[model samples]
Target: MASVHWAIQPVLALFVASSVLLTGAVERSPPSFVVDLDKPAYERWNSVIDANPDLGRDAPEIFKILTGNINMSNDTWGILFLMAEKIHKRLPAPFKEELQGMADRAKMPISLITLINLAYDLTAHCTSVVSTDANGTIWHGRNLDYNATTYLEKYTVHVDFKRGGKVAYSGVTFAGFAGMLTAIKPHAFTFSSNERDVGSFLENLLEMMDPNSKFLMVLIREVLEEAKNFREAISKFSLARMPAAIYVILGGLSNNEGVVLTRNRTHVIHEFAINMQSDRWYVLQTNHDPWLGDPWYDNRREAGETAMNRTGRNNITVDSLYDVLSVPKTRNKYTVYSTVMSASHPEAIRTWIRNSTELIPPPPVRASASNVVGRFGTFAAVLIVLSRNL
Candidate 1:
């Protein structure tokens, strides 16, 4: 009986050891997708570009500059996939483990994971334009007229939160233009008068964010409440010197509604007509990515036309050039005008103007001198005139 128990004990010990080994060997689930950036895809892309020499030959200098700066590695794609995974909130466990492993290996602050993710995403999208030439030379579209000096001066702060502490990374280059500039000049555009003005504006704007900054808040509130009044003041001051139409244009009056009170009210008609010629005048947001066709473009045009027609200036013919300012900086924070024209046959300015339903009331009819005299006073004067004629 003792020998049999001893034999069973050895078997139990072996079973326990085997269980531990199996547990240790078990692999965590793979990330929804593993970005193997170290693979041959990078080389394939380069090879394709090297085989096509005629494609970017016209812009040799630009191509050289662009290719020199770009990092076309598997790491770039991996980072992009990670960002997309996070944004979609569908990151796989294995991917998460890899990210954790990377952070641990680098001894980086955990909070910085998100910032790194953002950097990766931005870089990936921006560098997508970079391609290789037939001779195996990499080219970047952004290198054309690349001003390295101007690129390095702008900086933005990034904050990361991990493990209940904040990690700050300053002077990080998330954009290619910025990276080029950083490599060139660390502090070239600082201390200028223009910089000072911009700094002051930013300071004031920042102060308004603090609840304790009562004075700043009051000033902001006043400015907001008096915006229309301020516009009117500027308009009146400028109108005193320049022609009414010019003043209206300079004083932030481009639409028919703004010019209705001015002497050259007809100017709005011309401006509207001119704006219609440019394909850019109409745009709208969409649920699908902008790379996909935007369904809202036509809808936005119809809406803008509807709004313009409501202003009641449809009939006026304008010969003079109308001042059509681009969408104001105050309105669009991310206004991007694409270099490529999307539509084949953009709507004509005249057609849009003709479609406007807004009608400016015709000028008041004038009464004849004889009719005025007969209707009102001056009967004695009329008789005197008749007697003198006789």
Candidate 2:
């Protein structure tokens, strides 16, 4: 049996590599593509799935492996399974049907699809800066850091919702996932999330089961669709009981106002004003909660504060935002993409995606069969998307 498995593994590796190469995704830099969410949700997802057929199978498996690496137990998986089932029943029909379409097209279980979208407890570290220049142009910059091992090809360019009467907005996200981790509604506001805490497993499960429970992304979507200005946006956010712990930052061009809101499963813990006073023209958030006491937190917090201060409001620009976001001390090696949003003109969004070659770690000097197996795993994660101008 061991001999059979070893022989088949090499063949499977060759097949996957060939598949990726044939798609023409391997030869060029990875590209981003935009989706018009105004179209039926299912139709939009199906189109992307059709374009990258292998991703349908790859995504769920990636999540499964990730869950295991994180020491999540079978009992925890069971809880997530139940939560995914309940969350499906609670989602709006359009989004629910979208997951079903993706599952059918990808030939994967609907529960797995739901689990990938709903599970927000990741060891991702991100830094979001909401700032307004002297000219009143509000800018939101974010660096989304995560394990690049399996997430390289899952990246989606942007999701646009113009005709749905749903806050004409757009931003980049993962393929097939319904949640919006980053978005900017043109002429309305721009917002992003940085994971702060996973919260208790029991609380998260309960939040998922409650019919009235609303995930953070769902609540943010509502704010985008309905809120007309900064005040209205915060009002809506203030009322929501998010399902996980996250530090959310929102910016509006109308008032040049930016807010940093922190929430757990039950209530809003802290909300701070950013880019409010003339002297304080920016805000920063990383993985750790600000109020917590720790030396590492102090160092990172001071570094971010110093970076913002050195740039000065008079000198800040979109390019400068990227430079600060890319600072080695601030971002982890897992950083996959960085984005800059101009809230005043939301149509102007810029992103820098990590190259596929960077996905694989350096090979050790003395190689073994285990190293080959590890390379195979990395190869599977390197599925490609055809380059498209965004």
Candidate 3:
């Protein structure tokens, strides 16, 4: 890519990865669209056309790949969307109008648009960390992973949510998704959603149909727009009846203000925080419950914690924190992007669209007489297959 795209990847790898190999640049992603909440809801995504122009051409294909994992015919899926919509009036005020505008612009169905927006909730494979350095400056960081990383990283953009013509909050997301997965409230706090897949997607879908339920993404948006500090956000988010169980990590402007809230439907079962007294200055959460530890297969939590501890408190900064998160095992092939933020230092909100070679999924394989393989995203697997073909 152009020099403009090559921002922090090399320096980050060199600084953070003492042993792992890294190639290509993690592009400093551009803003796809800006949503002005003060305007009519349907007009909020208007800038999407000019800012992220390819969204119109790519929406259908993006949606198709996202739903590719699910087994259902188009007709059956259409019926399911309608049934869910009938039972649950989910698109409240700005979201429905915003979606309507996006659908009209993209020439896609509103139901499918809404489905993908909410789909971000169901596929919540991600890692989040909140830590304070020796000076007690809290830095919040996260890596969002999804099966559709190939598509998402291409259109990855930073969205600025504006109210009264000012940036109220912002987050890194794809072109068409309207909800918030990772967000920052200026000088208040930074928070992110990690999927707690204790229950199946069907259970979450049933909860979505309850009409009273709210997607965690929407709730995160609400928290960013509503809450002004760490404790307020914690109190409001902890009591929230989220449609599914999830972990919300919060990092605040003040010292020792970082905490991970482990929540179910209506209550926060536990609060894990930065313990300066015990020298546990960082809290990490992946897809699993933090206390039980990440499963042997998904070692993101373990790997991330190791990176954090390795980046000693005296040496922690934005670049160092990004390095901590750039570990190959932690930021794997499925990672779409990495966002680093500090509520205390709101001016330097940084997000990098992860596009390095190791993070890229293998290209689609051509049909061969001996094999009909589809994809081999891992580097070693791709190398092995390439050698066989050669």
Candidate 4:
């Protein structure tokens, strides 16, 4: 694994602390990070794995970064296999074929990819906000607060999936999973999942392997690919028993409304509406489950709602939304990347990534011709790993 060292300047203490609090990160400068994956599934993955052989060596550590201290014992794999066997029959054909192609091209085990996909939602928390700007542009924003570590920083990926007749969707995420933490399917809807800790973490995880269970990520991907509207997306959730507890925020571009569905293993416990009326036009969420109040959960939820109210929906732009998302009172040590999107406008998605520097700036450099190729290769590798996870 590669590492970058940071020097804390006594004088810059204020600046460093402010940056982390304001931006949910400390700096913008990163050392040599691997390429970002973005490609059509068939052509891009093989080149990615070839470029980053280190991924193989780092898999276990990477898994730890995402899943926390959970022991990946033989029993874990056994459960994953059984879960995959059941879920496999439910995935769309095109996606399954593409996933298999990714595994073949990457030369890794398909089960590895399946495990990563199934495990993605295991131990993560996030924030999701939905509101409309003055122009009535529906905005959906999400901040992924994963377990913190430098290794996890460099391996993030962005994927764009286009299946012939279905709406196209894309977003940034980790490799080795087909589910979504954040993504937008233009003209259709935008979606994100915020982890909600409800009961015994380990008990919930073990229950996820039941043959009747539908993993949240896989279910989200299904809706992204097939659902034609926001109503359909919500209906999809209403019909299935989600594998775990989570908050699914789905905003429809066409209808210009967003709903936050709180779910557990059996049914939807509560639902919140994010309607863009003239007066009250915003929605906010954090790691805490409103149903099961936790004072210990960070105060950022209140801070974020206040920030949104201060900015006001009428004044919210992509940059302004980023500003709101960056507020320290609304962030934590593990809060990594922030994404804001125009849910109704297909390609209008913006992502702010954290770097190793104390004073955060924009993403390292612009994509040149060579960098473009590398970006494509990286995207392919990530897709391959996520979809194919050997």
Best by lDDT: 3
Q: TM-score for each prediction? A: 0.16, 0.76, 0.84, 0.73
Against the hidden true structure, what lDDT does model 4 obtain? 0.62
Model 4, total clashes: 16
Identify the superior model by lDDT, candidate 1 or candidate 4: 4
Over 203-273, each residue of candidate 1 has an lDDT whose tens digit, in order, gives 23222223333221122212222334324423332232211121111112222111111112112222211
Query: Which stretches of model 2 miss by more than 4 angstroms?
Result: 1-34, 65-83, 121-123, 148-150, 164-167, 198-203, 254-256, 275-278, 293-300, 355-390
**TM-score leaderboard ranking:** 3, 2, 4, 1
Off by over 4 Å in 1: 1-90, 123-390
lDDT of 3 by residue, 1-390 (tens): 112112434544553443232454445665646788888877877677456666666655555455334334454465555643442244666666777787677776676667777677677688899989878889998888876676787777788888888989888876667777788888888888887877655567556655567776577777887898989999889887877888889999766899988888768888899888888888888888878987778888877877777667776777767776777667877778888899888777788777643545556433342342232123224333333332
Which is the winner by lDDT between candidate 1 and candidate 3? 3
Per-candidate local distance difference test: 0.21, 0.62, 0.71, 0.62
Best model number under TM-score:
3
State the lDDT at 320 in candidate 4: 64
Candidate 4 residue-wise lDDT, 1-390, digit = tens: 011112322222333356656646334322221222344444544544454455545655555446544444464445445555454545554446445655565565665555556557666778889887777677898777766335545556666664553436776676545566888877767888887777544455456646577777767767876788778888897678766788888777632487788877788888877654545577677767665544764777776776777667666676666666766655555666777886577666767565423333323223344544654454334433333332
Error of 3 at 379 (Å): 34
lDDT against true structure, model 2: 0.62
